[model samples]
Target: MIPGGKSFCTRHYKKVTHCLFDLDGTLLDSEVMYHTMIGQICEKYGKSYSKDNAVQIFGMTDREVSEEVCARTRLPLSVDEFERQLLDLARNKLPIAPEKPGADRLLTHLFDYKVPMALATNSTEQSVRLVSIARPKLFGMFNHMWTAASRTRTSTSWRRVASRTNPSPHNASCSKTPRWACRLQSRLACRSLRDFKPELFGLPPFNEAPPSTTVPIHHS
Candidate 1:
């Protein structure tokens, strides 16, 4: 368990009735696999793939990452070809990846409590399956799951699916109904999760709430 995991859960339990999780770095420890695979691909073409380059493409979609790599390294493949080859390599590497520290503990706690939870990831469904193959039970616990490959590959479409699954009470403009609302708004915005900020999507702000209620947990 991570330090302060118990206290963090206890403190926010009451305020959180629903949770939204990002898949790649937040739940599964698959970023390293991706970096390695991409590095190998670049090396095959006599191109350099550095940590600095990986950092820049960390949160990008497969197409975006492919385009960036081609732009930076001048790889001989087109964007579509690069994306296909990258995903093929990822399919072979991601299954061996593990979950992040404290991910299982937090997910189990929420599942046992029957908290409504959903996965909101920028990964394609195929890529998600590759990373999740080792933990079917854990992935199955989500009430809903949304991936970028489901419909049009647009950020707005991705947000629409996520918002539908875990409607943010903070967004009065959102039309979808949420399962429950809580007072404690906890967010995990860090390097491991690609420094994603839920507030940009109109999710609740992380503020100190009174003891009477806790808020939803949103991880990305």
Candidate 2:
């Protein structure tokens, strides 16, 4: 009996032979730190940065937000310098931000299944290095990683990744609600992405894609 896939596309869900995960919030517990840093940055610029603001930029790259800050608040520092500071802050804080509770277990089980995995993040190469060091056990399974330096970090890139990878489950950054961040209107919501076509959820293109017949049995 094939339980319906979480994504709208049956082809994607049923045929999913691999998994591609977004790094930061998906496997790690850095959402609070991310929210804090965004607050700190916005505060330095005399702008309002709140949890809501952090939520707003959930799936976006820091560079995009920095540009917005420069345009809106006219922040004095260069975006690169600003991003460096943010990364520095994150490095110092990584020890305290734990991995998400169930994520480690999920990753471990997936590894045991010999599931091929890829990690795609909007973070920089340095950030990736820092995270790998900060969470070695968690990152060891990833055979591939894509960072912000890639040509495909834009908002459009987000959509493209989802559309390009058939027979693979697209796991976005895992905040509490799993809603699309302003930058990531590309992928569908977590529930929709589980089996429904993202295009039907206002993220078309993958809309009405072939249906997947296999339902993965997940256990804690």
Candidate 3:
């Protein structure tokens, strides 16, 4: 969504033919699980992990989160040890994590319209699989799913997905919840799915009421 209307998209972005999405917080409500797990690990080491720590790791990968948590909290465990505990908790918690309110509605609308969509997340493939296992039908709609652990270049990852799904970065739209993650040339950051305007990206709009407000666009 944009306050300036078509002028914004017209002046900058090409008509987006494909959608790229972030997994955590955007689609899955797994942040709580992460917070809980990190808190537990910190407490075990006589330290504390707070909501501030959660915000700091908003778009971080598993290893990155582990590193940050360990460094920030001064936890006694090594990064690898912290990660092993985190992964263990995630394996148990993430599968049962709920989807955000509008996740199904928005994803299904795009899928039914045959719009190319991909999941581009900094999470690991193992993490994504565990989280999506409960809702295979929903997550399966993505034309492609990428994880940072794959060792691919980040920009190249987006471009490859774009070529396979839409053709170019200019013709793609990215949806991310974390502000720091919206560093791409064509990125859209929204607080919720209800604020995402598909028509602005040349995709089919929702059948229900229109978005209530506009969202910020970050392009380089």
Candidate 4:
């Protein structure tokens, strides 16, 4: 059973045949680091950055986040300046951020089993590149990856990629963190990912020990 005693539905899980992933808190444990960095930037302008502030930018693109932060904080910096600061901090911090527990393990399992997977994140390609530098093997496992900007530019690309696994979007499971982070929200939380039973989703079971920490998962 999921949290709140929601009955687990094996019927629906059986239909899921593909997986899409988000990066920040999904594969990488860098969501907190991101919030901290934004707060630090806001503090420089004598503004406080709260969870509420972070929530406002949850599903936004990189440029949109910069613009929203600058506007909300009244930070004298232009959007470019604000984004530059974020990039500077990211350069120093993101590469060192650890991958979410079981992330590599799960991805490896899926890859080994020939599961069709893709990455669909709001992060810029540059940010993805930086993070990938720290874990090339893991990132390389995905069949496709797209930034928010790139996704918008090539809207049909997702469909083309999704077709590799199943023709319908309803057949894919989107793996992501927290409910509010995406337009297609799922009820399950990050804690469930750690204890996830692959057999529930008709996937091969893990033959090794589970990781030490929880992983977040969302289905769409």
Candidate 5:
């Protein structure tokens, strides 16, 4: 939905040959670490941190998170200070690292399907290298990993979804055109076109989706 505009898309980006994956939340359970750090930083600044407002920034990059901290908490600090605090917290909190459940399994499965994948993370070069140290095998897991700060780096490194029509029709008449093909955006990562969800696009997340085709797998 175009905010308020009824104007529909003349075209759509539907089928995705390549997929971008966010490392922190979408793949790794790093929110607990982030929030704990944020809360500590806010205490030092005498600012109240709201979890609800914090949840608004799950998929954001580090710079985006700093901006949100300023905007949401009205903290009296330059973005640089915020960044320092965040990094300090990262250093203190995450001495060792672990991958989210099913992460490697999913990577192997997607790789087996011959689908290209990239890791788009907000972490800087140093932090990115650190996170990588947590999983050196990650080099074989993804085609690339791009830090969000550098446009040139991310643009060239990460795989871009090639297909232009990731369409899913729900209530819209087959005769009528769709409002959009997909809602992919900056700092947001998505699965491939074949795994796209139609109903969860606009509305609240369903408690559970109706059971669809389930393929049995043998974990050797």
Candidate 6:
């Protein structure tokens, strides 16, 4: 578990009445699966997959990643064909993807408290369904789920979805940029599920101080 994991939530328990989460790296530990599958596929075309490539495609949509890879590798596949292949490969793998640390605990705590929660992911609806099957109980806890595939094909869609899902002034979101943070009015930005600080999102601090800690919190 990340340091101050317990206090991270306890500190912010009261400030938020609703929560929105990013699915891929934030809630599900599925990025490794994506990297492995994409790497294997790229290798089949005699293209190398590097760490930098993975970082560049981290928050991109399926079509975007496919286009990027194809452009970089000169793959002969069309965008649609490449995206289909990726999704086909991912469907089998995502069902077994693990949830990120603290995902279940935080989600369950919020659910049990009757706090409304929504999933805002860059993944397609199909990918989201695979994750739902993999983590049914956890996925079911969300009051709503939105995917980039279902929304308009624009960068602004994520922000629209986040704002649409939680119009409450006290709502909070956990995600990196372009997925759920682009133009959304969020109180906190969590780089990963484990390193979140609820207190930063307007939740009151814990009565007792937690151990000093620091972790990378990505922003875009």
By TM-score, the best candidate is: 4
lDDT tens digits by residue: candidate 4, 26-72: 89988888888999999988899878889998756678889998888
Q: Candidate 6: where are CA atoms >4 Å away? A: 1-14, 152-159, 162-220
TM-score of 5: 0.57
lDDT of each prediction vs. the true structure? 0.65, 0.59, 0.74, 0.72, 0.57, 0.69
Q: Which stretches of candidate 3 lie over 4 Å from their true place?
A: 1-14, 152-156, 166-189, 209-220
RMSD per model, one decimal: 12.1, 11.3, 10.4, 10.0, 11.0, 10.9
Give lDDT tens digits, candidate 2, residues 1-220.
0112344544433333455677667666677787787668768777776555554566677677666555555667888877777777878876567776566655565566565566778877776788788678888877567788875663334434433433344444221222345356433344322344323322223223578999999999
Better of 4 and 5 by lDDT: 4
Residue pairs of candidate 4 with colliding backbone atoms: 190-216
Task: Judging by lDDT against the true structure, name the best candidate.
Answer: 3
User: Which residues of candidate 4, in runs, are more than 4 Å off?
Assistant: 1-12, 151-161, 164-190, 209-220
Instruction: Please give, for residues 1-220, the per-residue lDDT of candidate 1 as tens digits.
Output: 0011122223332244356677777798788888888888889889999888998887677878999998988998898988888988987778878888767766776677665577877788888777666678888888677787665543344345545553332343222222133123223234443243223332333333657656788999
lDDT of 3 by residue, 1-220 (tens): 1122133334444455567777877798887878888898888889988878888887678988899999999887799999999888889899998888788988898889776788888888889888778788998898788898777734456665555554333432343233445555334556788787766665656788767788788999
| Alpha-carbon RMSD, candidate 6 | 10.9
- Candidate 4 local lDDT, residue 183: 47
Point out the worst 10-residue segment of candidate 3 by lDDT: 1-10
lDDT (10s digit) by residue, model 6, range 87-203: 989978999887788788778766776656777777888999887877789999876787876756534444455555433332233232454453484434456665665456444
Quote model 3's TM-score: 0.75
- Cα displacement (angstroms), candidate 2, residue 31, comes to 2.6
Candidate 6: the clashing residue pairs are none
Give each model's clash number: 6, 18, 0, 1, 7, 0
